[model samples]
Target: MNAGRPELSGTFGAVSSTHWLSSAAAMSVLERGGNAFDAAAAAGFVLQVVEPHFNGLGGDVPIVSYSAATQSVQVVCGQGPMPQAATIERFRSLGLEHIPGSGLLPAVVPGAFGAWMRMLAEHGTLPLADVLDHAIGYAENGFPLLAGAADAIEVLAPLFETEWTESGRVYLPDGRPPKAGALFRTPALATTYKRLLREAATAGGGREAQIAAAERAFYQGFVAEAIDSFVSSTAVLDATGRHHKGLLTGQDMADWRATVESPSSLSYRGLTVHKPGPWSQSPVFLQQLALLEGFDLHGMGLDSAEYIHTVTECAKLAFADREAWYGDPDHSDVPLDVLLSPAYTAARRALVEDKAAEVLRPGSPEGRTPFIPEQSAVDWPVADGSWMSQLANGLPTVVKATAARNDTCTIVVADRFGNLVAAVPSGGWLKSSPVVPGLGLSLGTRGQTMTLQEGHANSVGPGRRPRTTLSPSLVTKDGKPFMAFGTPGGDRQDQWTLGFFLAAVDFGLGLQAATETLAFHTDHFSASFTPHESRPKVLAVERNCDPEVIEELRSRGHDVEPAAEYSLGKVCAVAVDEKAGLLRAAASPRGRQTYAACR
Candidate 1:
C-alpha cells in the first residue's frame, strides 16, 4: 500500500502528534538529549496551547510509558475524580437526571498538570521550566491559530459573549473571534504558568524538588485559590440551560494526585498489548483483542464487507461490556480478570454473527450480572440548534458538526535508549465549560460521563472517577517495546486505533499505510458523554471505502452511512525497531495539522 505520506525514520529518536507544533516541540526535546518522558511532557503542554478547542491545562490525561531500565510498562492514571461536593443528591436537587456536557457542575479535579509534573519528576531528566518553555512561549507571544480553532470560536462566539463572558474575554479580542492563520495570544495562561515556575524557583531545591513545588502551587496554593474563588462566586449557564455553581473546590484539588498503576494487558501473536484499567474505556480495547485473537484476521481482507462487519460486531459487544461493567476499580468491582480471561472472550466471540445485531447486549461473566442503564425516554434539547440541524443533511455532517465536542489529542514519543510514552491529553475543551476568570483555563466536563441510576457501576458519586473514553495504546513484541500509538475520537478512539494496529500487525502494512487506510466505527453502545444516545447497528464508513463493500455491509443489516474521506480519525504512532536501533513515526493525513518528526 502506498501511504499518502512517507513514513518517518530516524536513528536516535522520533515523535508523532495530532499537531505539527507539538511534534516539532517533542523532537526538539529529543535533540536536546531529553528522554522520551521529557519529550512527551513538553509535547503535551504544547498541545494544550495549540489545540485550545480540544484540550487545555485544566483537562485530564492518561499516559502509558515503558522504560528500558526497568523493562516495565506502567500507566499514569490522570483521570481525576469528582469533587467532594459532587453527589447524586445535589444534582437531583437541581432537577438534573444526568450531568450536563458543558458546565462547572461537571468539573472534576484537574489532572493534567499533576500527571505531567509526576512524570517529569520520576522518569524524566529535564526540569519543569524546560518542559514548559514551548507552551509558555506560545501562550505569551502568540501562535498561529488553526482553521479548526477559528471555526470553533466562530460557532461558539455568540454563546461566549452572552453566556460565558469570561471565555469571550480570553478567546475573542476586540469582541471578535480570531481568524485562521492569525496570531493568537493568551497572556493570562502564560502568567499562570510563570507564577508556578516562580514558586518552584523559590523552593531552592534540585530538579525534583522544583517540580514538586510547581505541583504544590497548582494544587494547594495560588492556582487552587483562583479556581475555588471563581467556582464559589459564579452561577453560569450550562448544557442544562440553567445557571449553576460548580462542585469542585480548592480542597478537592489539594486532595488529588496522579499515580502510577500497572497496565492491563493481553498477549496476541507474540505481542503484549497494554492499556489503562477500567477507570477508562481502555480495557475494552484489550477485550476486543482477546475476542479477535480467535479469528484469522489476515484471511479476512482489510476493509472487506466480512472484515468490517466482524470488527463492528466485536466492537459492539466489547463496548456493551464497557458501558455495563467498567468503572473506577477503587469504587466498583470491574471483574477485569474474568472479562479478559480466554474462556470469557471465547464466549463473547460466540456472539458475533455474520449479520449485524441491532441491540445493546452485555454478557454475564462469572455469573455476575451486568449493570446496563435503562434507556430513558426523556428528550434533552440540543444545545446548539443550528449545528444539530446540519446533522440531518448527510453522514459527513454527523462527524463534522460533532467532532470538536468529542475530540482529544494524542502524543507518542520514543528515544534511542528504548524509552516509550503514549499519552492522550484531553478534556476542558474551550466549548465544554467557561474559562476560569484570569486563568485562561476551563474545567473539564468529564463528570458528564457518570450516570444517576442507582447501583450502576458508573453511578455519579463524590470522589469517583467517571468512565473516560480517552485511551492510549502500547505494545511490546517478544518482551521488547514495539510501538506506541493513539488517536483523537470520543467513542471512536479504540475502534480507529484497533484498526490501525490490525492493519500493521496482521496485514504487514507500514505505519503510514495502516493509519491512512479507510476507517469506520459503529454507534451501537450508549455514548460516554451527556444525554447518552445509542444508534443500534449503525455503521459509518469513510467515502474512500469500496462502494461494493459499503453496499455489502448495508445488505448485512447495517444502517450504513457515508463519511468524508478525512473525517474519521487523527491517529499518530511511533514504532521502535530494537534490533536495528532505529525509530519510525507516522501521523495521519486526515487533519491539516497532524505531523511526525524524527531526529
Candidate 2:
C-alpha cells in the first residue's frame, strides 16, 4: 500500500467526503446512533454549506445506496426536470442555439433538498432537524473558508460585485473575497434553513410528516414564492450575451419531487458495479467496464503505457455512446440492455486498438435510434475569458476549472448496521447562476447539458431532465456490499473512479493507495457542459505520472497534455470487509479539502 495516507479503519462506521468538516459531521451523526443514511444526509447538508462553490440548496444530487435490512440496492434520482415554460421554442425566441452556462434561463427546479430529505425519511433514524443540524450550525456560527472556495470567490469577485450583487453580499463580506482559513458565515442561508425547520415544526405530526412539511415549504411555500417573485422581477445577463428572466415558477416546484429507481449495473471480475441510470453519465462507467472485461489488465501493469492507452481508448468509446444514447430514460428510449449485452461489448472492445482513435464512434445498438447532436462551436463567453478562451480555441487547458465552478461533492458512508450510500451532490455553483435573493442560494444551470436540436434524446424541452454528469459508484462482491466510491470531475467522474476501482481490485492496492495513484482523463468525447466541445484524441495525465509514459502516449497519436499533479480529481471511497468486520475509508489529497474519518 502507498505510505502517503493510511486507509481509515473502524468497526463501528466510517464516512468520507469532499470536505473535512462534512466528514466530521457525518462521523458525529454515526456516533450519535444514526445509520449510514442519516450520516450521509448530514454530511451532504454540511457539504452544501462548506463547499458552496461546488453545491448548494438549489443543486441536484444522485445517490446509489444499499440497505442492510432489504439486502438490495437502489438509486435516488434527484435531478429536476426543465420548467413547464422551458422549451426549444422559448430558447429560440431568445435568439440562442444553446442554453447559456450561467443564467436564470438555465435554472431547473431545485432537487437536492427533496432528495436528501427523502433519503432521511425512508432509511434514516433521525428527524430532518437532526440531520440538518450540522449544516445549520456551520452556516449560522461560521466555518473556516477553504482555499479552493476562496480562490473561486476571488476569480468571480468582479462578476459578483458588478452583475451578481446578492452573491457579492454572501461571498464577499467587505467588498472582497474572504481569505483562505478565515472564518466565514452566511446568515441568510442559515435563516433560510431555520425557516424550513420552523415550518416543519408546524406540521404537528410524526418525523416523516415534519420532513414532508419541510419539503412542501421549500417547493410550494415561502421559498417557492421568493424564487418565483425574484425570477419574474429580474432579467440577468448570461453567457448568451443577453439578459433573460428565469423560466421556473412555483407550480413547477410543486409538481416535482425526487424519485427512487433501479441502478444500472454490470457484473465483472467477481464484482458487480452499480451507477445511476441514463439520466446521468454513470452508465458510461459500466459500459467501460464491459469493454475492459475482455482485456488482461493485471498482466499489463497498473502504470504501463499500454494500460493507460487501453483505458483511455475505452473511455472515449463509452463516452461517445453517452453523448449519443444516454439521456433521461423517462424522456428517451435508451437501449440500455443492448448496450450492456456481452455481444455488444465484445464488438465495441474489438474497436480498441494499440493506437488511439481520433474520432467519435458510438456503437449502433440493434433497433435503437441513436441521437447524436451536431457538434457546434460553443458561443457562450466566460466572464474572465481566461482558461475558457483556451478551451474555446480547442487548445488544452488544465482541468482545474473542473474542480472550481463546475465541480460536485462526493459522500460515502457506511454505518455499523451495514448500510452504505454513495452520493454525488452537485449543480448550483456560484458561477452557474446569481444567488437567489433572501435564500442565499442559486438555481441549477444543468439545463446547459440539453441540446437545442429537436428530437434529440437530450434536447431541451418542458419537463425533460437534462442528462447530468453527476455519477456515484457502488460495488458489491459475493452478494454483499463491498465499496462506495466517487469523485468530482464533470465528465471525468467515472473515468477517475474507474481507475481507482481497477487499482484496488485488479492491482491489489488499498483504498488510499488506489486513490492516490496517478489520475488521467480524455476529452475525446463531447463534453457535458455548454458548447459541448470535443477534443479528438486528447488525453491529460497528472504530472505525477512517469514522463516516459507521457511521451509514449504522445507517440501513439494521443494529444497528451501534462496537468498539475493534484489538479486531476478529488476522489473519495469507502470499502467494507464483512468477513473481518472492518470498514476502510480513503479521501483524495488532490484538493486538500477531502477527508475520511473512521472510528
Candidate 3:
C-alpha cells in the first residue's frame, strides 16, 4: 500500500495547491489575516509565475467559492469566450475542420486577470498590491525552476530559437534552456505586474477600487493593447503546418468580463456538491456522483475490480453526456436540468453492467435528440513546422496517443472565517503561443477546444465560451462549507477528483489517504481539448492497484493499461471540520511538487 502524507489540521487557515511556492504564498496571506479569497488570489498569481509551463496570466480560471458571510456558493467564471471574429465559416473558408491547438488563431480574451480581480474586489479585504506582492517578488527575484518546467523549456528550445523568439527571450535567456533547480526570473512579467499596480494606485480609492482598476489595466489598458498589436501584426505556425493570424482584438478583451453565477449542484449522501455549469466539464463530476450514489461503493472495496469497473463505467456515461450536452448556455440550449434529473440518472445508471461497455452512449435528456460529433479518424497534422509534439502536458508517460497539451494548476483554500475557495487556472502555457513582446505572457488557446462543426453544442461561434476541462469543486454539508478541492488533468479532472471525493466520503478515509489511494479513469469518450482523441474502452489504472484486480478487470472486458504509481493525479484539497472547529488540508504526493499547509 502507498504511504499517505499526514493530513494538516489547524484552527486558523489551510491551503493546498499544485506547487509548494503557491501554497506557501497563500499560507502567508492567511497568516497576515487575509481571508480565503485574498489568499486564493495570491496563490493564483503566484502559480502564474511558478507554473508557467502549466498556466499563465493569459489563461482562464473557473473558481467555485463558498462564503461564510453569505452561506452561499458562487462560481466565478474566468473562462474567456471566443473572439467576436471567430466563426465556423471563417475557419471553413481557410479549409480548416478544427481550431488549431496552438497559435494566434485560437486566442481568446484572456480571462484569469479579470476573474481574480472580480473575486478579490467583491469577497476579499486585502489591497490589490498586497495580493500581487508575492507573485511579483517571485517573478522579479528568482525561484528555483521546477524540473517539469525545465524539461518543457528544453523540448521547446529549438522551436523558440527558430520561430517564437519572444518566448525564447523570456524562457531561454542565455540562448539555452535553464537547468532544473536553477534560480530563474522573468523581469518583464514583474514589470508588467508593477505597472498594473501603478495603474491601480491611480484609481484613488479603497481596496475594491484598486482591484477594479487592475482589472481594467489588464483588459482595456496596456496588457490588452500588447496582445492586440502582437496578434494583429504577427502570423505564427500552429498545429496546421502553416502560419495564421488570430481573431482576437483589443476590443474583444475590452468587451469581456468575468461574471459570477450559481453553480450546478447535486445532493448525494447528505452532502451538496457544487461545480461550474456546463460551460466547463464540471457538472460531469456531479453526474458521476449521482450515478454512483445508487451503488454500494464501500461494500465493493476501494481497490477491488468491482469498484474500479463501476466507477470507470459511470465516468464513461457521465462524460458521454458532457460531450453531447455541455456548452455555453448563453449560446446553446442545454437541457441540464433533465440530464441531472433522478429519472434520467436512474436510467443511465442501469446501463452500467459487469462487462465494460465499448460504445459511447449519451442519453436523450428530456426526450431531446443528442448530437454526437462524427468521430474524425484523421491524426493530428505532422509537419516540420508543427509543434504539437512538444506542447502536450499533464498526460501520463505511459499513454501513447497525443492529447491536449494545455495542462493546468489548482489552488484550494479555507480560512478561519469559514470561507472556502477552489480555483483551477489553466491554458496559455508557455509553449501554447508566442509571448506578447512587452507583456511576457502568451494568449491562451482555449478557442482550440471549441469545435468548428455546426449545430453541435460546443461548436465555434462569436463570443461563446469553450466547453473547457478546467473544473474546480466545492462541497457543503448541512448548509455549511465542507471542502474545496480540484486537480489539473485535462479531460481527467472530473475522473480523478471523483475518486478522491469517493475515497474520503464513502470509505471514511482521511483526506491524505483518500488522495493517495489508487485511482483509475477511462478515456472512453471524446477528449475536450485539441486533437480531441477518443480511446474507447481503455481503462488507465495506477500501478498501485493490486495486479490481481488488474487481471480481473481485463477479464471483465476492460482494456487495462498500468500507469506509473502516483502518476494518475495531483489533487489539492482543503476541508473545514466544523464540528471540531478545525481546518484540514492535503496535497497529493503524485507530482512531488504539491504542498499543503495549515495554521
Q: Which candidate's TM-score is highest?
A: 3
lDDT of 1 by residue, 1-599 (tens): 23489998898898999998999899898888899999999999999998998889999999999989899999998888999888889998988777777778889999999999888888999888988999999999999998878877877788788889998999899999999999999888999989999999999799999999999999999989999999998998776666889989999999999989999999988899999999999998998888888888889898889999998999999999998898899998889999999889899999999899978889898998888987564444556554332211111112353322236899999998899999999987787778998788988888888888888878888899988999999999887899999999888899999999999998899988888988889989887765667888889888889999999999999999888776778889999977777899999887767899986
Candidate 2 residue-wise lDDT, 39-149, digit = tens: 999999998898887889999999999999989999999999999999899989878877777779888999999999888888989878889899999999999997768
lDDT of 1 at 236: 87
Candidate 3 has its poorest 10 consecutive residues by lDDT at 393-402
- Please give the range of 10 consecutive residues that has the lowest summed lDDT in model 1: 389-398
Pairs with backbone N, CA or C atoms under 3 Å apart (clashes), candidate 2: none
Instruction: Provide the clash count, candidate 1.
Output: 0
The per-candidate count of clashes, in order, stands at 0, 0, 0
TM-score of each: 0.96, 0.96, 0.97
Ranking by TM-score: 3, 1, 2
lDDT of 3 by residue, 1-599 (tens): 23568999999999999999999999999888899999999999999999998899899999999998899999999999999999999988988877777888888888899999889878998888889999999999999998878877887788788888999999997798999999999999999999999999998888788888888889899998998888999988776767888899999999999999999999999999999999999999989999999999999998799999999999989989988889999999988898889999999999999999999999898888888887564444565432456443213111234222225899999999989999999877787888899999988888877788889888989999998899999999999999999998889989899999999999999998898988778889877665677889899988878989999999999999788778877899999998888999999898788899998
Candidate 3 local lDDT, residue 469: 90
Q: Cα lDDT for residue 141, model 3? A: 98
Report lDDT per candidate.
0.86, 0.86, 0.88
Task: Kindly report which residue stretches of model 1 are placed more than 4 angstroms away from their true locations once superposed.
Answer: 1-3, 377-406
